[model samples]
Target chain A: MTGGRGSGLARLSLNQKTTNRWSVAEAVQGCVRAGLPAIGLWREPVHEIGVLAAVQLVTDAGLRVSSLCRGGFLTDPTATGRQAALDDNRRAIDEAAALGTDCLVMVVGGLPTGSRDLPGARHSVVDGIAALVPYARERRVRLALEPMHPIFCADRGVLSTLSQALDIAECFAADEVGVVVDTFHVWWDPEVMTQIARATGRIASFQVCDWITPLPPDALLSRGIMGDGHIDFRGLRRAVEAANYLGDVEVEIFNADVWDADPDEVVATVTQRYLDVVLDG
Target chain B: MTGGRGSGLARLSLNQKTTNRWSVAEAVQGCVRAGLPAIGLWREPVHEIGVLAAVQLVTDAGLRVSSLCRGGFLTDPTATGRQAALDDNRRAIDEAAALGTDCLVMVVGGLPTGSRDLPGARHSVVDGIAALVPYARERRVRLALEPMHPIFCADRGVLSTLSQALDIAECFAADEVGVVVDTFHVWWDPEVMTQIARATGRIASFQVCDWITPLPPDALLSRGIMGDGHIDFRGLRRAVEAANYLGDVEVEIFNADVWDADPDEVVATVTQRYLDVVLDG
Candidate 1:
């Protein structure tokens, strides 16, 4: 079953964090074993094995790099803070270029600590992205703005809706800055479908996961596997497909249960669910 | 301090849920002691004391009923379920009328259990509200659609944005159906100010609560007092004020700490916060 290649498997990308325990090498091998043609890489794990070695390892395994985990957190209000964030993101862009993936998912930082200035924080995000655009464009890396769920607005990502992300992404060239349509983050948006349609060419990545309720105390780990929660993955998949988003459909689950499970077993489950719940459903 | 009346206190309304332990009579007395001119009523507490007596309690206290807590949960898929919800909402409208508050806050129910059909659930909400509008009009009650934070979209309220709520509310007469502008629910929205301006005279209740991070295990209890978290309450107040929302500014916190605190102290804190953080900040 692991060796059998299917058309749906080609579109499926095992996002590294989904199998949280797996190292970059382990994740790549798992993708190859599961017949997934692609794997999304996270910076920390990629850096663990060294970016050059990580790139060589994935290339040797014949796996496509679907996307890099992130490159944004640009909501700092201080000049020093903004510069540090930009410098780090430049490094992230270099990593994305080295890894041979144009897509660099961006989770813009939330409000500065002890600050009630939401508008100021959001303005900084736009300005930070503007500053990074030329560098990203030169590197041929796309800054995929991720509009996180509103639950993360205060602490994780200030970009709270796909429409809001698109508004910012539109300011730059489509190839320079794009948006991520992650079901876990955006499924509840009333305008999600409308925004997805509008995203068309600007959709850099389409991440799939379910939004489970009774959110654990740690909301960052609240995502469920596609079939385990309330998301209509097939509908979202179809919407993106219709939006001309012919890119990797990265399965990015952040649930503690998925992380705790054996990586091989988790990969098998993702494969089956991606086919059943996301593709064929 | 409780006996001292200030101009800021006149525009303030203590949403009963903020002091979760207070019964209808207790809340009215608390409002009076705080020198607050208005109080937002909850259906369960009103029913607990009998709506008519609760009305008399507030009336004799010389307090105004700013708005009724809720009259929604209308996203059921089954005919029986929908009918039961509609019936319940009609009773809620009656209760709102009896309480001498035209604004019946509507927390349009979330997706039905075991259902991933969010669009369908949202449709049911609109249909349900449409069915309730005529009855509400007859009772001289305004159905105030409360666009809860998107975090509650799956299990509590499908109406996740003020703009989305206004879309449905605008379909009905402005006097018959209106929308709520709750800071905790919408402070993250990039279009919040624009939507608030669009709402104009249709703003039924302008609720304030800060969006604190590290949300508790129960997301429902995530609200903080106006100054305790990241919301810019004064900006929101000014926006609503500019929009000509000459109604009560309700403080509707749901934090466990707030609930467990002495209700009088909480009331005092809310009053002081309303003046310093909300009115004068």
Candidate 2:
């Protein structure tokens, strides 16, 4: 199962925390310095330095781009917002293609403003993805819809379950559309193993994070470090591997404390903890 | 269907906010004075005033007991904790029986402490209920497993989806276990309507509260009052009725603001909102 220790461990990737405190260049350098193999780059930092410069920076540091941070917020009550989101996703895809990332992760937006129509919002997400799949495929970038936790159903991502995400993925004719299974989002799912099996080769990425000790209303801000929270990362890894998903095991913690710490220390501590908790588990 | 206005709207039931501002008797009197039909009593206040006194207060006010605030937190890792929880549940059953409530709602706890075993915690919940079922049934007090939002998968409630709750309920004998579909917890579910149909006569109660804007970490403290947030109460009502759940729709908001307000005003506002937004919708 180790596939030889070094090679197997090399599959670890870091999803730069979404906060602007860390730049893409700095994040790439941090991963390289930590002997980490890959990094999941967020768009804002890349956009700040220009996509070309960001791509060059990663390439120069010999860091693999596992996935792009995001590409979708497709639910818009109006045509103008919806079209604008699609256009932005197109740019995201182009950026991912330039960076040579494995996939472009989509955090599909929640219900449109002033609407409680969850199903309608989901339909809009599917429609938006279907519209963008052709463009994504043309750029050779896989569009991975990240199913956020149900708490975000009101104002964040409408795709709140892996089954729902897989259903949306099936709507497209090609495998270009896939699902990103993040531990923070899905560790609590009773059907996690079954859904992971259903995902199998269709899983574009597998992200890991821990559930915090004290749950806050804005849960997105309080994610635990790999070993800090109660998620069975080892068990999840086994399930994902059993499902034939050989994607990078991306560490994506969103803890406020971790963010406030030194970025280098954050990367080092997370990488070591991921190895001990997940790989060693 | 209001069943025609002359029949009078189904009376709103106030679930006394958990903050320490009001005693059980005070809440009951406030509901009665506000012309509300029912009150859902929590355990702590019952403990404070004693169950017999709380029951007498409601009886004197001619206030119906819609449901007991809660009964289950059965996901403890230790046998001692599990046994104690079952004992507490039995006490809760006695309290509910004394109050003549429609049911004893169960907030089945999440993963046990120091463990990330979700399935094991779920098993504990099921076994706990199985152990308590005969006692509850003999007392003529129904058990209502209330599925909380997925965000509470760690410390609060593990049964986060309606379908999962129904699955657990199906494991029990007829009427041994039913479900409470709180819109605040499940309005975001993609399978809510389908699960409502599946739960049709098996529903012990229906709860209504809006999903708050900018959901905070302590979600229990941020619950929006009926029609205050984004839930389509009319749609939810139609679905619940379609499922043959003819129970009173209990307004169970745990908002800090509502709790800080005058209990009379809270009851009046919730009653008016229930009539205008839910019944009229």
Candidate 3:
């Protein structure tokens, strides 16, 4: 059962699942065939297909670019590594600008190599974002900082909660730095709804996915498909929409099972499920 | 190549190696023989030897009871399940009171069964703890809320950040609630030091362990022994001690590999490691 009938379907956007199976062009075409309105493109896919070509393909497919998959890996204890990450983020900003995407999602880096200095890493993230803000603002590209789950605190992203991300966003001037509300990451957060309300106008992008049972060894890449796992997407959508986030609701799944399935089938199943449960709610 | 040459050897704790092979009595005797000052006791071992008996064994041996393994699983969506958890927690508080332990550790339950309502579960936890606080205070037993990693957000603990736990603790009067700072769980927190400072006098327990590479399926149970994982316990110890927490530095490990070893050997290794790293540093 959906969250009260007649709530209406939430918008559907496809995040190119982080697998090498489907090319960017193919994924965009698949979304079109499945009747999905938007797509969240990853950097590697765009890089592989060439930024100009990827942009052209999205434009041709008549699909909205919900977000650019990532932009930040800011935690580099060393100057060399830090500079490199900032430089890469600059490139991502350029790519997002080229694609005419809604925003560039940021997965702020976790602890620096060989160290447990969490605060140090976080400081670097704030600094990295601050340094990139001017350029991002100039290009009119929103930097959406996506707070990962605490499981990724060691090797992935240091910003592990919606409140933490919002704090970082608040440090930046308005509109330049925004927050990305991804259900897979923040669904378990106790303050998620409260933070979503606080994030109202600051929400650059919104993503949806499910949390599965029996966590994987590498949880960063083991998210569940929309209806296959246990998350109240309709409830989450209602919260976000209540906060006045009119941005596209992107489906970002990182599951081996779905990747192993037929790509077209995956798209079709997700679209139908989204329409039935989330949108129709 | 440790934290510093003068820092001395790494201090290891037996928690990283618990696979249910040792009894509480055996582990305590082993720690004393190995010259380790403190030992963390789990519930099953206490139950096996009987609470009073275990407490007597440790006390008579001059071994400090660092912190009770756990006491909270407060979130249960159903009234019966919630009451059952609180009832069990009451028993745990009584046991801690009898053990003369520093604090009763609480691993607050995650999302309620078959439900993805994280906030609801968290509220239940607060209510559950508020219910237990009076009983614990009456017994003069301090409650230390240990925030588990976000990976456990679905099935284990809803409170995933030290800040979140600290906030919950602050809800109660200062003396009634405190926190168990486990390096394995909080090492990746972006606000680790700041939150630690905020938790200064409120810090009830400080547990040390390691985070090994290539996490396994049961990541929680696969914790690394001190010095074997990535955590810098010496630095962490300094932070906690700096916070004015004048308590035993409990060596709490949950490693599958260490548990399979002989209990005596496990104790000996952990004791030596703890002396070499923690006390030496």
Highest lDDT model number: 1
Error of 3 at B95 (Å): 2.1
Per-residue lDDT of candidate 1, residues B114-227 (tens digit): 999999999998889888888888988999999999899889999999999999999999999999999999999999999999999899999999987777778999899988
Top of the candidates by DockQ:
1
User: In terms of lDDT, which candidate is stronger, 1 or 3?
Assistant: 1
DockQ of candidate 1?
A: 0.85
lDDT of 3 by residue, A154-267 (tens): 777889888889998998765899999888888877678899999888899888788887776666567877776668888888988898888788877887777788888877
What is candidate 2's TM-score for chain A?
Answer: 0.95
* C-alpha lDDT values of all predictions: 0.90, 0.83, 0.79
Model 3 per-residue lDDT tens digits across residues B20-84: 67678777767666566566788887887788888789889877677776888888878899889
Error of 3 at B16 (Å): 9.1
lDDT of 3: 0.79
Residue range with the least summed lDDT across 10 consecutive positions in model 1 chain A: A1-10
Question: Model 2 in CAPRI terms: which quality?
Answer: medium
lDDT of residue B84 for candidate 2: 91
TM values, all candidates: 0.97, 0.96, 0.89
- DockQ, each predicted model: 0.85, 0.69, 0.54
Ranking by TM-score: 1, 2, 3
